[model samples]
Target: MSKFDKALTAIEETVNGALLLSATLLLFINVILRYVFTSSTTWAEEAIRYAIVWVTFFGASLCARNKMHVGIDIFIQMAPPLIKKCLLAFAQLTAAFFTAFITYFGWVSTELVIETAQKSPAMLMPMWIVYISMPLGSALMTIRFVAAAVAILRDKTTGAEVKNEDAVDISRL
Candidate 1:
């Protein structure tokens, strides 16, 4: 990978890992406090919830970058090379469009929350900070999708087969 790609991957992986670890640790400590100490942090649950939401959104972008999202490619695999290429291109473009749509609407929602000055109940953090995840994640996914589409079309035009990262091995299964 190029330096920029490596850096982006590192950032995505680091953020996802840190958030997941923090959420798990916080939950474990909260459980211990609730049972043994008979006291718990009021903000723990809310923090965990928001952490999970961010993790999920960021994870989706990570998945898009790795092409790890679930897909049923039985038909595409069976199709002729030309048809398969067309199908793959179509799928990628469609996904790009969907993610772009989400990014646009998500930003709008985040802006509205910002204007309202909404705060999260427990942490009192600006609601826009949390709400912005949708746009940010979808924007990343949109870029990935567009890149995939370009790669697919380019490879197809050059008589190369498109390769998916998560291709299933039936014999192993």
Candidate 2:
């Protein structure tokens, strides 16, 4: 893999690992407290909720990286080569544009959260930290979408199938 690809993969993996560990620890603690101490900390639930939000954002980015996002590929598979190429380009462009739009609004949302000094009710943590995930994830997915689009264009122009890092069988989708 290229260095860029490798770096992106590493980042995704790190985020995934951290989020998983946080979720696991929070849940474990919650369970232990409930069963053993008969008392639960309010912060634990908020922690889990924040972890979940992070997971959702990063997981979406990971899905983009892996090309595992939901799609109606059956129709694309049946189309003629040129049509398939067009369809692929259109899809990639749409994704890129949408992500870019979301990234802009996400930044605005993050700023609003920060400026307002929003805080989680239970944990009392800055809400901007959670809101920041929106722009970050959208930006990453935007990059991934652009890469995929370039690969598609290269394939169409050179008649070479670009090997995708996350390529897999349709069954897995």
Candidate 3:
């Protein structure tokens, strides 16, 4: 993989790993406290919720990186080669546009939350911290999608197939 690819992969893995670790630790602590002390802290719930949001956002980017997102390919399989390429290009463009939209709005929403000084009810954590994940994740996903689209276009122009490591195996599916 190129350096850029490695850097992106590393960032994704780090985010995913941190979120997973946080979720696991918080849940474990919550369980232990509830079972052993017969009391639970509300902060644990908030922590877990935020961790879940982070996981989801980063996970979506991971999905884009892997090309594992849901799509209908039945018609593409039957279409002429040139038509299929056009259709795929269109699909990628649509994805890029939507992701960009989300990123823009997410950043705005996060800033609004920050400016409003919103806090989580249970943990008293700043709402912007959680909301910030929205834009951050969408940005990551956008980057990944852009890279994939570029690769696809390059492959098409060069008469080479775009190979996705995580492409679904129909027989297994």
Taking the tens digit of each residue's C-alpha lDDT, what string does model 2 give over 91-124? 8878989998999999999999999999999888
lDDT for each candidate structure: 0.85, 0.81, 0.81
Ranking by TM-score: 1, 3, 2
Candidate 3: worst-modelled 10 consecutive residues by lDDT: 156-165
* Positional deviation of residue 28's Cα in model 2 after best superposition, in angstroms: 0.9
Backbone clashes, each candidate: 0, 0, 0
- Give the best candidate by TM-score: 1
For 1-173, candidate 1 gives per-residue lDDT tens digits of: 37866787788788889999999999999999999999999999999998888888889988987888777887776676788888888888899999999999999999999999999999998999889989988988897888877877877363235565567645465
In model 2, where is the ten-residue run with the lowest total lDDT?
158-167
What's each prediction's TM-score? Answer: 0.89, 0.87, 0.88
Error in Å for residue 131 of model 1: 0.3
